[model samples]
Target: MSLRWRLNLLIAGLNLGFLLVLAWLLVNNHRESIREEIEAAHRVTVQMLGTAAQTSSVFGPPDTVMVAFLQSVGRVRANEIRLIGTDGRLLFGSPPSEYKAGRTAPAWFAELMRPTLDATVIALPGARVEVVPDPSRAILDAWDRMVLIVLVGIGFVALLHTALLYALRHLLQPTEADARRLVATTRELAQNREVTRLIHAGVEDERKRLARELHDELGQSVTAIRLVAATIERGGALPVSQGAARIDAIAASMYDSVHRIVRELRPAALEQQDLRAALLDMAREWQLHHPAIEFEMHLEGDLADLGEEPTLAVFRSVQEALTNVAKHAAARQVALAVVRGDAGLDVAISDDGRAGAASLGGSGRGLGGMRERIMALGGRLEAGELPDGGFRVAIHVPMPEGAP
Candidate 1:
């Protein structure tokens, strides 16, 4: 009715078919073996009868000897032995009469039973013909039993296969439930985090815009006003020299504020050079800020050449890692490695801080943002505190096809 049922049925059918075929093959093989054995035994008996005839003159009357000989052969061989007199009366041995009453042997078996090439037949002193019951009929009967056993085995195997599928479905039900729940939870968490990240990025962009406006528009107005005030102070417009000097001091203060605002708008170094040069400059600035911590950077490969997105992701990842290390890792030395390979690029930032893996978990949102940025660029980011004490971030970015 359902897909699961159909799948189970299909598998069961295949298994049953295999079992049945195997059973038939085994039955056929057994039947052939039995037939060969019976035929061989028949030949041996014929040889013994012939030997008795040849030795009749030396041993005694062959008729009496042959009667006992035929009986012995019948006892030894699986097939029934029959000695037909001239009138067709069986004088020595015969098969069960019930065998004749059973289903008639097929034409093929009957034809095979009709004797072919004569075997070594022993003659009694009085002369007699020896006949044996068809080995084919006996073999067929054994084969029929074998077929029945095989059918039964196949049925058992089919039952086992069906039961196994049923058991697996039942066992996997709970696991399937857990998987669905896990998927749901992951989706919800991702949506919430995505919204939060977008909001944060928007706020940051807005701040940069405002800072640019302040530096460009407001700073220019302030500079113009300061120039006017300096001109007035230089022209001796103010009665007191101290008052004019105060105006100059205020103008200088305004100029410093403009410089600070311009810096806040964006790092000037980033605009002047590419991402590699920019990162190095930022590292130098970070080291200036955190003089106690040692910063080491090694740039290998062609990182300076990359798409805007990938380059930006790398730059931000480095920035975030360093920022995180500064805030969380109370370490002495920091190592930043950027390796660009043919496949893509790798950036690893490690610090010899007191924080280990456990400490990095709740260290804050910087690592999460770094991870998201890398992920959005089709890269992977791994962040954890190193075992030997300190935090480390490893990032991998896969290059586009044919990208060198």
Candidate 2:
């Protein structure tokens, strides 16, 4: 349920409970009041009749005089007076009350409010008087009063509920505004990711072009210089031959350096879109150069078919991590692992180097760029110091939907 409805229900329940408790209290109070009133009226009626009976017995026929007196007294409030003869026949009975005579409260309500009282019997010379308590009028009064109270209580609760709902709606307006702002922010983030992806593609294209230029232009030029210098060294005088030989050696070194830079700029394996091959080749190159540091790599699942974007993201992230490790992590061991699962790709690169050596704390452009690339592919990158004085970089890239 929504917050509004839940709170509304809560308030409604509380109001209902309050109404019930109020009714209960009112019923009890009215019941007690009716009991006291009826008891008092019965006592007064009995005492007066008894006194009249004693006076009639002294001066005249007690039964006749008492009946005459009762007739004069008429119906009593909340009491019924009856004179019974020796043959068990009622000689006189009080008349029914005229106030609310035809109507009575419901049985359930009357039972709830009715008070218990015993009849008072007084002996006469040849007859008897019986006073029975009646509480119908009082019960009817309580019922009418209760009906009014309930109506009022219900109205008040309804107004309170409406007021609370209006106030809650006003208070929750900010939450709706926040929801709108969140949606806008999410759209902006998606746009930013698209921009980052485009930038990455442009960067890769530029790298490919630079690598081609260096390999074709600079590399061929250096090779041609080496050929010309070799020719001069074979035919010139001893001093001239020595100079040509030096030039040929320098040209050869330049050629080799150009080829290395070309390879670094655009690896052949990446050109084939084979992430596994690229990672293996890069690890082999690192192991060859840094033989003193033990380099370990573990590969799992098929990584050759990943789309170009995610493949590049994972490869560059690992490449930057390894570069950092070599430059700062003066450790004896490094491990790199990549796994393709049902849901996505996972990569972990760890080095048993001094903690805090690689500056993975968002201070370096290398790590920041890596994060951008990974995030563009809807992936995450985490770099932190291990518990045992080492650093680890973990990356996760979700598999694109509907891809094999």
Candidate 3:
């Protein structure tokens, strides 16, 4: 069931339980009250008849005087009186009660409320007087009162349930609006991630094209220039040879610069689809350039089969982190670790740098880009200042299904 219906059911159950308990209490109280009322009335009637029986002998013959007295007294409330003669013939009986005379409470209600009381008997000289307790009228009164209370209680509980339902609907309105807004936000975020992933793919494709062009076109052209200069140097003319040597050296330098740019655009290790080898190559190059700083790397698990997208995302994140460390951290030591487990791949790059050095500089954009890249790969990236005066970047990328 929906939450609203579940809440409604719960409230209904509670109200129903309350009504049952209220009815039970009302029945118990009324039953006891009726019992007490009948008992008291019955006691008074018995006493009066017994006293009258004792004094009847003074008036005349006991049975005749008692019958005359009973006729004079007529009906007593909540009690029945009868006189028996010496020959076992009925001499007198109390008249039936006229108060609610023709009506009685339901049989079930009467049985529940009926009190147990002993019939009182008084012996006369030639007969006997019997006073039996009667509680029907009292029970009928209690039943009437209980019916009224139950009707009122049911109405009150129904009204209470209606009010609570209204209040719950009113309270849930804002929650419904918030849920819609959350759904919209989630959709927008997913679209943005898709766009980011497409953009990253396009950029990598462009880089690969540029690297291939520079290597095939510009690199070969530079080699041709070097060959021509070598031919001129073989001529053995001092001035021409010197000029050719300078040209050769410049072409050689330009060739080296082009190769470096191509490597940066698309590393050979990545072209071979080996992320571990790419990371190691990058680290070795970084250490070569920044010989003053200490660089460390640790790799575990099978990095070769992580697919191009995740491998590229991790590679770019580490690359950006290391560049940021070189430019901003000014630290003595840097450590990079990449591990793959059953869940996914994890990469961490940390540097022992000045506190908050990475964030203080223009590193936010780079870090943000790296985070977006990782997120697009169904992963997450976290970069922050470490507690002991350093900076760290951590990235995780989930493995695609059936990946080795």
Candidate 4:
């Protein structure tokens, strides 16, 4: 259920799967090696029987020799040597197969050993000799060796299990530590962001109050000054008229300055229009400040019904991004896109500039405010350089229910 346990299980499963594969390969290889060794032993046994056949021929009537040789072979329970004419009567050779009652290996063991032997019959002076494996002693020999190997394999597997357990714990220990560190870092970041959010909210409230005071109080006073100056200019001496005109001009300039302040405090475009118009207005205004930059914008789908927080977050995010590009990127070309999808709104602002440069804003460079604003609105923001070239700022804000 917990992440650490799930991760450990995943890693352990993979390691165990690898061990099982190795065991399968080792078992198959061991089985093959045993089979080859058995074949080699059979060849050696068959060769020995052929040599006895040749040695027995040295005698005039070798039947006695053959009988002695086969009887000796039976005692060893290795190879069966037999002699019989066309009549199928026992002429002169080893005893019957009843000699091997309890001496044989179990049937399962025999089949597993699976000796591949064939009878090599030779023509002699009087009768024929058949050379075939007796198989009891040979199979028992192989079974004993195989059992030793099985026990060793079992011990090896146990050793491997212990080593793997230690190794997994050792290898994953740092990773687990790093994960815990990361979780702590993320928690701290969230707390800091909450504090920043509160600070920004208070600062924004102050900005609104200042803008209102400048607009209502200072603006009314300036308007009254302009009215009095105009009246004085209308019916006065020439010098007084010129002085009043200059006074009226200063009043007008001050009013325009205050209006600009109010507009920056609470963006008028966002107030008067929806997200689409607001974003375009922000981009167009930015372009005015940087006439050298070739800026482009693409707005897709309907975005009018996106509510207060979403619209404000999107507009402010773009506004900040373009400002960064204009001030730092030295970029000649830039593009902005806002897409409305079934999931949410997606915004990307990018510039074709020297990427990875100091000006690309590794220090968060005012984009930190943008990120905090987006995150507070249930959106995500990513700012980095594109692989091919240039820097990009991308944001995705999920659409709430009943959103247009």
Best by TM-score: 2
Worst 10 residues of 4 by lDDT: 356-365
Candidate 4: segments with Cα more than 4 A from true spot: 1-238, 359-362
* Model 3 per-residue lDDT tens digits across residues 1-404: 98899999999999999999998898888878877888898889888988998899999998999898999999998888889887888899888888988999999989988888888888889998888888888888888888898899899999999999999988876786799999999999997886676568657865786878777767776776766666676774446766667677767777776777667667998977799998988888889889988998999999996888887888888988898889888899999999999889999999998755424432455776777778878898887888888988888899977898
* Candidate 1 structure quality by residue, lDDT tens digits, 113-198: 33333433344546565545355556556556665787788778878886988887877566877989999999989977875876
TM-score, each model? 0.43, 0.54, 0.52, 0.44
Estimate, for each residue in 4-65, the C-alpha lDDT of model 2 and write its tens digit. Answer: 88998999999999999998999889999999999999898888888898899776798988
Q: Give the TM-score of candidate 2.
A: 0.54
Please list the C-alpha lDDT of all candidates, in the order they appear.
0.69, 0.85, 0.84, 0.72
lDDT of 1: 0.69
Ranked by TM-score, the better of candidates 2 and 4 is 2
Count of backbone collisions in candidate 2: 0
Determine which window of 10 residues in candidate 1 has minimal summed lDDT: 113-122
Candidate 3 C-alpha error for residue 196, in Å: 2.9
Most accurate candidate by lDDT: 2
Residue 16 in candidate 4, Cα distance off native in Å:
51
